[model samples]
Target: MTAAVAVIGTGTAAGWGRHRLGRLVAEQTPERAWFHVHPPHHDLWGAREPVVCDAQLLDCFAAGLRAELPVVVSAAPPKPDGPTQRSYAGLAALSRPSGRILVGVHPADAARVPFAAAGCGLLSRAVPGLPTGAREVHGEVAVEALPGWMVGTDASGEPVTVNLPPGATVLVCGAGAAEVVSTVAVTGRTVGSVAGADVA
Candidate 1:
């Protein structure tokens, strides 16, 4: 049997002192789903991308994420939706950062987090070889999918390719999480599959 898998999105909840880490489990009894998690308050708020937090809260969250098959999907918003919009400014606190990613992936697991840092327009470049049909929240761009990977034009309009791994889920929030997880619930596949079965 496949081990339990969990996906989490980090952000500061509006009107709350604690930070929120939205969790999506693929092995709920009734049905797999996303649950709201309000961790203890920490002074490390409003830091830069891949924000770090208090060791206590970070350890707690990290412990919760650990499993036989653990997967943490921390979504760092490239740009804030608005002044009031929640964002994951503290992901690096819980996970280590190599270059631009804050992550915790089991080496045996075929999972990777390749996302663009703030101000970079071509998000697809972060995860080279993305399939077609990648929906950019900020722009309308057409991308093509190769047989084993994907290709898209980057900030300088240069062709960039990305190869997404199986079971990779794009970290999202609220309604977006619901939509993405619902599809996973029905199909028994990751959102990356929706992007293209070749990758997932």
Candidate 2:
């Protein structure tokens, strides 16, 4: 069956988190073909193709669904100030019932993401103590590498952390944070082989 993971939030942190989470989901489920919907700023290493525009994104999701693959989408949170909120809503609308939504937000802005919390299956952040639910993945910094941060969580809910090479924090806040977001992305998947396909 077709599955999808949408990483939605605001600012550069959200962007980087989306990239990290998408990669993690892809890694967890390599048996199926994967498509990506990412902004121009982010670079996706492996994907059958890159989907641009809302129409193309929807089309890719539909195609992946038909092919029983997975579509990884990175979108801005559905907020009034967010430029791509409409796209986020569209993705949410289309991925209902079986799709997963991972919302990444700053700890201070936790209360501001009410719209997403209504439907999101996972919440990723640097700190813990969010309103309790079965869908929250809390992350905290455990160490500070020379140029990277090691994020880990000891929260009661699902723990999301991944091991990464030192100083690999280019696109994400840190490797640890990336792992946290990614853990939420693939929380319950079995988790890729299209080569040379245009990954925009």
Candidate 3:
């Protein structure tokens, strides 16, 4: 069985948070692979060349899941159109039975979250604020009142907060968020366990 598969997206084209979360999941897994579907023109940090396919990106993603390896698919924001919507629907069907997850990073692709959540076995969201490079905090982001154990820091530099209910996880990355400096500190703390459980 595939350990885990995640489709990550962000509202903006920059994709910093989306990439960060994907990288985090990849780092935590034992033998992980990266795939970029509909990749941007600029080079991605750890992803390989684009996996183009006639099915509007579903083939490559399906291949990854079938490999039974921990994989992350970096995709464009989901659209409501026929082809795009069907592709996401296909993603959900492939992921759910295998017990994987889909992530919507901060400033998530609002259009994609619902489809992603429906298709995957589990759904996680990095909420509150988009990861920023500013040295000092510009403003406060409102953390959602989710129900589970929350990981990651708030804008005030607090250690942890409570949100994201069971069978789900939430990672908070506010403006001026640490650039995921340590996998142990960020992903390893939360996502590592999530992936590890599924793999076992």
Best candidate per TM-score, number? 3
lDDT string for model 2 (36-130, tens) is 11212122221112222333433343343332212232322223223343332333332212222232333343333332322221112221211
Clashing pairs in 3: 92-119, 147-165, 148-163, 148-164, 148-165
The weakest ten consecutive residues by lDDT in model 1 span 32-41
By lDDT: ranked, best first: 3, 2, 1
Candidate closer to the true structure by lDDT (higher is better), 1 or 2: 2
lDDT of each: 0.25, 0.28, 0.29
Score candidate 2 by lDDT.
0.28
Q: Candidate 2 or 3, higher lDDT?
A: 3
Cα error, residue 115 of model 3, in Å, equals: 3.9
The model with the greater TM-score, 2 or 3, is 3
**Candidate 1 C-alpha lDDT tens digits along 106-179:** 43322221221111211112232111221112122121111111123569974342233333334557755553
Off by over 4 Å in 1: 1-50, 67-99, 107-200
Minimal lDDT window, size 10, model 3: 35-44
Per-candidate clashes come to: 8, 2, 5
Kindly list the per-residue Cα lDDT of model 3 for residues 28-80, writing each as its tens digit. 43332221112111221222222222232333334333322122332322222
